[model samples]
Every structure is written in C-alpha cells, then in structure tokens.
Target: MSATFNFTFDDIPNLERKVAIVTGGNSGLGEVIARELARKGCKVYIASRSHSRAEAAIARIREDIGTDENLAFLELDLETMKGAVMAAKFFMKLETRLDILVANAGLGGIKSELTPEGYERNFGVKHLGHFAFVSTLLPLIQQTADGNVDSDVRIVIMSSKSYENSHPIDFDNVRTTYHSWFAFLTLREMLQRYSRSKLANLYFMRELADLVKDRKNIYVNACHPGLVYTHIFDLSTSPLPWYMQLVGQLEAKLLGINVNDGVKTALFLAADRRVVDKNIKGILMYPGPTDGFVYFSNIYIRTINKLGLDDEARKQLWRFSEAALEKA
Candidate 1:
C-alpha cells in the first residue's frame, strides 16, 4: 500500500486544541508549514535561530490566518546541541503535550567550516543537531497520548530530492575531510553531505518507526518538498552568478511552486491518518497534482534498495546517533 494522499489548505478541519512545533518555522517552507497547521486550528510553536525573524513570521501567520490562532516562537540554533536542548526544555515547561514535530530546519551548503563545538556546518546543523532536538523532546512526544488509544504523535521530517545522491554517513570522519574552498567545489561537497544527511533522516525515521511501532500512535515519515524557492538557495555554498539568480527569479515567476505548496508533503505526513501504521515506514513522498498535497512514487525505491540500507545501515545509524548524543 502506497502512502500518498491529497488535501487542500481550506479543507483541513478544526484542530482546536492540538499543538505543533515546527523547526525553521520562521521562514521559507517551514513558515508556510506552520501557517497551514495554524489554519487547521493547531497551536504552533515556531522554532528558529533568530528571535526577530520568528516574531515576524508569527505576525505573518496571524495576518494570514486572520484569527487569534495560537502561534508563537522558540529560539533554536541547530548549529549547537545546547540550543536544541534549551528549546526542548523550554517547550516541555510550556506545553504538557506535543502532537506534531516538524524537523524542518536545515542548511544547504556552506564553506567548509566547523561550528563552535567543532562539527561541520552542513551535517552539524542539518542532521545531528536536529537529532539532538528530537532526542530532547522524545518524552513529550510519547506523552502526547495517555495510553495510546486514539492519540497521535507524528513527526514529519522535511527531506529533499537530494537524498538520492548521498552515501551512508561515515562516522570515521563525521567532519568530512572532503574540503573545497572554491564555490562550486564546496557546493558539490555540500550537496553530497546534505544528501547523505537526508538519507540518514529516512533511516532514522525508519528506525524510530520500529522503535515506537508497539505504541501504535506515533507516526514518523520523511519527505522531499520538491523544488522550493526559499532560503535553502540563499544558504547554497555556490557563489551563484547573476544569471543563475535571474533564472531562478524567472522560474519562480513562471514554473516555481509556492513555498506553501512545497510544504504540502509535510502537512500530509503530519496530519493524515489513512496510512498511519508502520507499514508505510521510510517511504519518501512528493507533491501531488493539486496544491497543498502529496503522492508517493517509485522513482527512488530502487535507489534505496541499491544502497544496501536494509538492516545493517539502520542499525549503524542508530548506534552512531546514540554515540553522537552521548558525546554532546
């Protein structure tokens, strides 16, 4: 059974008391996702690196929703586990339960640099840091349901089409020695690193799905949002020429989809109950024929199979993730 579905923004019924936390919710696809959740009456917590930007996003959500929908911001810096831990702690104190977690915060490619804690910027912010965030908030996620009857705790990981191009993360050199100072070279390396981390996202989701399968209430899925015009490009390691930017602008004007539209997969994976079981674990989703929608296709299944990612890779990533958290 394929895990694909469609729904319009105006159609989501009242969510009234449900609460959600969307990392990177201050801008781009993340902001659009948060707004959509709010439209459904979900109380959304926007987590991002900048307070001012998050505040502005909340204001925009208020304007778009045209109601006193519960929307707020939490400062979360994905470059460091400190920030992730702090955000989780703060959220736990404020909310008794969390219905959804959108691990959407990510970096594209940056010049090879280490964070203050000495992790590569791309993998540090995009994967391991968010990993820490999820770990910190796992308890709240489990608490969303009293005894796992009808209660649902869903996590929608915002992945990218680039997952096709990455390899399993090599712990031997978490900070990839593959460094390049040139803009294009750095971009290539970043793309590879980013793709690898996104693949990790899929594996992690699969592992978590099995870990919580007995709970029968929490749904974990990963998806690619298609070609979205967002800060993702701004974070690109490549020094894009003016012509490229012009082409991008023209694409947005002509064929590029709305950021909100790009986030439809996140919304579908988060709220849809049709295929909430572990049977749909690790399936990558994409936008469908309509606005604010999703559908699963076989274009990437063979690639996943080819990667020998069955049990060995999953176990390895789980072990690596635990050790990384312990080190942090």
Candidate 2:
C-alpha cells in the first residue's frame, strides 16, 4: 500500500541472452524465480544441493516452457567453502559471464547440528556458504557488469521478515567454545537464535550494497518473500505440535501465496527498470500483498526504512561481514 513503488511487470523487457544463477532453484521461491527467468529468455542455472530435485525441476520446467537451451542445473552445497568454490569454478568454465546471482538457498534453524564442514547448520548454509559463493564468483559478476555497460549485474539475497526478531551476526561468537550449545537452549532461545541468523541475512545484503556502490552496472540487494508455503517447516525439530502444523496448513490454504508469487518481488527488483536507478543501488525490498488484477506491489518504503538500514549501521555491518568472509 506504499505509494513509493508501483506493482507492474510490464517494465521488464525481454532478457534473451542474459545468464543467471539461482541457488535453491529446484523448489520453493527459487523454483519460481528460475522458471520466470527461463520464460523470459534468460539462460538460468538451477543450482541445487539435490540432484533428484534438480532433475525433477528441469523436467517440469521443460514441460511447462519447452527445453530451453537456456536452462541447466549444477550441484552446489552451500554448507562448505569447497562446494562454493567448485561450483563457481565450474560455472566460470561453462559460461563467459554471469548477469545475475540469486543467493536463495538457505536453511531455517535446525535445533540438532552442524553441516559436514562443522559449522552451525543454519549459519553455515544460510550465510557463510553463500558468502563464499559470492566471493568466488565476484570475478564473473564483475565481468558481466563491465561487459554489459548498460545493465548492472544483479545479486539478490533471499532474506526474511523474521530478521526483526534476530540479533546481529556475532563475529566474536561465530565459532563457539561449547559443542553442546544446542542442548542448553529452551524453545524460545532456539527461536531467537534462528532470528539472529535471519538478521545476518539482512545485514549481509545491506553491507554488500554499500561495498559495491561505486562499481558501475552492479546492484546488490536483499528481500523478504513474505510468508509462502515451503518445506521449511519440515525441518523443524521434533515435529511441531499438531496444532501448529495445522495452523501452517490453514495459512497456506488461505493466506499464503504460491512460491511464484512469493518470488515476484525479487524478480521485479532483479529485472525491473523502473526501480533500477542509482538510488536503488542497494535496496532492501519487501514483496507486499497483491491487489486483485495486479500480480505484485513494492512495499519497501513503508517497511524497510523503519528497520534501521541507516548508513552507519550498514557500513559497520559491511566491514564486519567483509572481515568474516576474509577469514573464511
């Protein structure tokens, strides 16, 4: 309902030769973003952790829009730096450039454990993994930006509204001293930790935008997809109470939008020209409710400014994140 943004897709022109990589593109919001890109003539790499899911996604996409020489898949596990580097190297050989990088693959807080790399599961996959992915792939993204001359290389991080409840990335505490930190927390504490991770996602986006501001034809941003029906709940610890699950089901049935719709905000910011001005060089967007007859709305002004994405905080977080990535 904010007057700052318009809800229309007509602003995006054909994306024919453009190449994009969408992590977690096999399911949920990522799937919808990849499909839309393919539909619009983008060569999309549906990078996923599961080969089976990737295969099925490719099959479905092929059926819906025909085999696009533009669509392909790559195995990427964001849980480790090696996987991120390998995927980046593989892509560098596969294509001459990368026009868009959607860091959408993420895991909600798992009360149980760590990834194969021994980092906290949510923090590892959600931030550190994606952090390494971008660092390794920056050359390609930079090249694409330089080559295009007219369009910026878009990097959209998939963040969440749950960020409000979380704390900033504790650079000091990333590597904990205690192995059993998981067992000591109550349910509410676990939720707070999860929220803290989500906050990191937002901070990462904000910091990235500032870091890349001087570069021409390169825009970095983050967004919240609102509430969508995804398998995130399936990963909850010890199976949520039946009533809670039932509530989620009811929300999906009545309140939740399809992943495709959920992803439209990212798509808009990633490709839309109206909001692509220099002012949007580092935007934090929120996808608002769609009114009848319109597929999307931009809720950035009403939502983000109040969230303390001020210049000072953004710069501090950027420095912190840069340090974290450098050490990793």
Candidate 3:
C-alpha cells in the first residue's frame, strides 16, 4: 500500500451524544464515514435515495459495530429539489439538532440529462439539491449551536479536485441539454458540468461561512478526497465497452487511493478538535502530504483559469439556487 495518510480513524475524537447525517452514506467513502462515526457512539443517519440500500447499510453497520443503536436510515433523494427539501423537513421533525452534516453525496459520469426541474444532472444533484437541503436545514443547525454551549456544528461539503478545471459558472447553459453526439464532440462541456458543480460546493461553503461569521461554533468548510477508486469512477466508464471499462478500472487502481484513506480529511473536519481549536472555517482544503495534514489545493484535469469565481458570481449562484428551490 502507499504511504498512509497522517490522520487515521484513531485520531477521531469521541462523538458520544452527537448526531450526524452522511448523505450518500449507504456506500463507498460515505459508508465508511458513517461506520466510523457510529463506532464512536454518534447517532448517524445514512441519508440517500434508496431506502432498502440504506437499511442494508445500517444493518451491516450494526452487525460490524455489534449494536442496533446509533445507526438508522434517512431517505434523501438528491436527484430533485423537492426530494431534498422534503428530506430536510423530515429530519427537522424527527430530530431537534443536527451536529454534523457531511454533504458527501455527489455523482458524475458519461451520461448527461436534466432533472425534472431542468438542471443538468450533475449540477442538479451535486449543487442545487444540496443547496435546498442545507438551506432548509440551516436554521436547525444554527439553533443547535445557539442552544448548546459546547456544540461545534460542522458542515463538511464534498468538492472534487476537478473543480480547478472548471471555467466560470454558465448560468444560461446550466438547464440546456446537449445531445449525445454534440456532448461527446465537445466533451469538455460534459466534464465541466461535474467540475463546475464541485466548484459550486466551494462557493456554497464560502458563502455559508460568511453568513455564519457572527454565529458561535458553526464551522463550514469544503474538501476533496483525492482521486479515490470508487463506484463513481466505475460509473464514469459505464458507457464504454466491457474491455474499455476493464482498462479504465485497472488505470484507476493504479492512480487512485482506496475508500478508507479517501475519508481522512472528511473525518478530520467532522470530529477533530483542532478544527474548532484552530478555528478552521470557510477554507478550501484537500489532503496534504506529511508535514501539516490539511492543505489548500486541487487537481485540474484540463487547463483553465486557476482562480475561483468572485463574490458576485457566488451571490449569483445563491440567488439562482434560491429561485430554483422556490419552484419545488
């Protein structure tokens, strides 16, 4: 195995009496995060679109941790704005507080389609869907901080290193559909959909941090897990022929980290005392080499403007997202 990350599961502080929601936690890196948090005695809700899969994940978590307690499923379908809002509303009714939100559910691949609400699938699910979920849940998170003196409410947004490759947000084209032939011809646009969505994650995190600057103990941040060999990569290769898929998987096996190591930075931001102690917020971070654990950087798959969007662009995104949420 490659040199392990400096941070490990052992470093995560005890999360007893805490509550967490790991979106897309039914599998892959999110599942590992859910299990690790549950291991530390935190009540975790594995939020996803698939109830049966969520239940299975909960069952496996219970079996391995040897406890029926501290694990359950919260159905959250990020494919649509309505699903996102409803899930947040359901959680609001079910629980009084939300301590940690790992906005970890994200997807991208060869397909290009629009959600019912008319957004590109990647942009719809990764950015707009989470926008609705977090917007609906923001009050509860704020209340948790206001009410509990010891509460350090953390929102960990999952962005990708691919974000560096994205150009400015294309508001007009966001809802447009590119035919398969056209999309494949200008493949950059297809890839940009996912990358831009990730950049949106960072934009959301930054704006939230500024909004909560006055609020005590609320930490908002975004991170990338490095390139992990997960189902997402498999999905990326789905449209390819079988032999091509095999070749892609083999390539990923060489280039990407495993799911276990992929989760380190996320867990650190979630439960590490140093986050609150050092007051790390609003910063874009990725796993570092050795010296200091968290570093600010991203991987660019294609050459583009290296800089992120300005504040005006982010404000525009927020306004556009809020308007979109209104439709649901």
Candidate 4:
C-alpha cells in the first residue's frame, strides 16, 4: 500500500439539509460512502437497479448510522438510457436541490455483451449511462448552485487507474463481435474494454469541467478510489479463467485496501471544505502519502494528457452520447 491518505469520514462536516445521490449505493465503495454521508446528516438517495438490494442497503445504513431520516432508494439501472432518464426524473420529484451527485456505480470484467440498446455493457453503464444522467440533471444541479452561492454543488465521477491501459475509444468498433479466442486472451480483451469505459469517465469529467467552467459554483470532478477488495468481479456468478482468478486473489490479498479506506478520496471530493474553498473542478482526486491527505496535484496528468484529455474526442463523446439517448 502507498502511504495512507489523511482524509477520513471524521473530516466530513455536518451536512444537515443537504441532499445527495449515490449511484450503485447498495454495495461496496458506494455503500460505504453513502452510509458515511448519511451519518454526517445528508439526505442520501441510494440509487440502484434492484429494489430489494437498495432497500436492504438502506436498512443496513440506517442501522449502522442510527437514522432513517435521510436514506431512501431510487431505481436506476444503467443498462439502458431510459433507466438513466427515469432515475433523474425520480430524483427531481422528491427533492428541489441536488447538492452532490456521485456517479459511482460501475461494472468490470465480463464476457463481451451488448445491452438491448446496442452498446457494450461496460461502456454503456460506466460512461454513457452517467453521461445521460448528468446531462439530464444539469439544470437542477445548476439551479441549486445558483440558489446557494456560498457553497459548491458537486458531481463526482468515479474512475480508475486502470484507465491508463486504455487506447482511445474506437467509436466504430465499440460493440465488438464476439469470437472464439484463448481464455486468457479473452480476459485481456474484456479488461481492455473495462479500461476504455474508465477512460470515458475521465474524458467526460475533463470536458464537463470545461463546459461548465463559467458556472463557478458547480464543481465537476473525478476520482480513483484506490484498488479495494470488493465483489465488483462477481466471481461467484461470473467466474474468471482459473489462472486469472488466482492472480486476482493474490493481488487482492496483497494490495487491495478495505472498502472504508477506498472511499476517502470520493468523500474528500464530495465534502472536503478545502476542495470547495479552492474551487477545484474537473480534476481527479486520489489518496496521498499521509492518512488524512487527499491529493489533487495531478498524479495522473501524464496518462490523462495522453489518453483522456483530448478536446475533439470529448466533444465527439458528448455528441455520441446525446445521439444514443435520442435513439433510446
């Protein structure tokens, strides 16, 4: 492990009257982050596809945080563009202000599969789904910011360091035709797709920061929650190649941080007063050498410049996403 980040849940201030949404808040890092935010007195809506899972998560969070005043569930299945729009509409119905939007839900290594909407599952959920959701909710986010000039409204996109492995997105070949390949090679291909999805997150964040730069009070940023041992792989339901599984098991045991520790950077981006005071936006936040430190010094600058921070690509992605939503 690198030096522990100094930022922790204790650093979060009272969030009374604040309203936030955490996508995929039913499990893993999202769950931990949602629970902590509620503990700080924020009204949190845990958005997920599974009603039962969301309800169970809400119950667990309430029991853990000793409150049910702020926790609720919103149905959001990123598998389709309709789901994303519906999720945003649901939020609008319940609240007038959206203080924070954590686009934290995502998927990883799986067989090449396409959603009913004709997009790759990983790219659709991790990037396009969030792209549509944010676009739909931008007005509300901006309105909230306008009313509260004293503080910042946050949009936190969860990205990953694995994005370093991605090549520029091949708009034409996004939905690859599955064919027979060596098992290990198939794993490699799937991981590359995953990387591409994460790369989309970074690109979207950078471009969004630029698009909304004049807004001032709406802070748009991305974060890499350090490698954590979570059920993200869904190993029981979607087993990996034996050797790959062995390698993953070894890595998890040796290097992965616990979920609680993994969520600090996101929490920092969402609630750290320093981030708001400094007007930090469109940057990627991660942990630093000390336990309470949150690094916004561009550690991923090289990779981001190489693969993520392209002006034309960002515009194309936005256009493509809009078209996708239109078709859906």
Please give the TM-score that candidate 3 achieves against the real structure. 0.89
Candidate 3 local lDDT, 169-222, one digit each (tens) = 889888976644443443566677878899888888878888999986999987
RMSD of 1: 3.6
Which of the two, 2 or 3, has more TM-score? 3
lDDT string, candidate 2, 249-314, tens digits: 566556766666678668876787655653465656776654211334454532564444656655
Show where candidate 3 strays beyond 4 Å: 1-5, 180-187, 236-247, 290-306
Residue 40 alpha-carbon offset, candidate 2, angstroms: 0.8
Deviation (Å) of 252 in candidate 2: 4.2
Model 4: pairs clashing at backbone N, Cα or C within 3 Å:
5-291, 5-292, 6-291, 6-292, 6-293, 7-292
lDDT for 289 in candidate 4 is 36
Q: Which stretches of candidate 1 lie over 4 Å from their true place?
A: 177-184, 235-255, 277-280, 288-305
RMSD of 2: 3.9
Q: What is the lDDT of candidate 2?
A: 0.71
How does each model score on lDDT?
0.73, 0.71, 0.80, 0.80
Order candidates by lDDT, high to low.
3, 4, 1, 2
**Runs of candidate 2 exceeding 4 Å displacement:** 1-3, 8-11, 172-186, 235-243, 289-299, 302-328
Off by over 4 Å in 4: 1-5, 177-179, 237-239, 289-303
**RMSD of each candidate relative to the true structure:** 3.6, 3.9, 4.6, 3.6
- Name the lDDT value of residue 135 in candidate 4: 84
Alpha-carbon error at 272 in model 3, in Å?
A: 0.4
Residue 118 local lDDT, model 4: 82
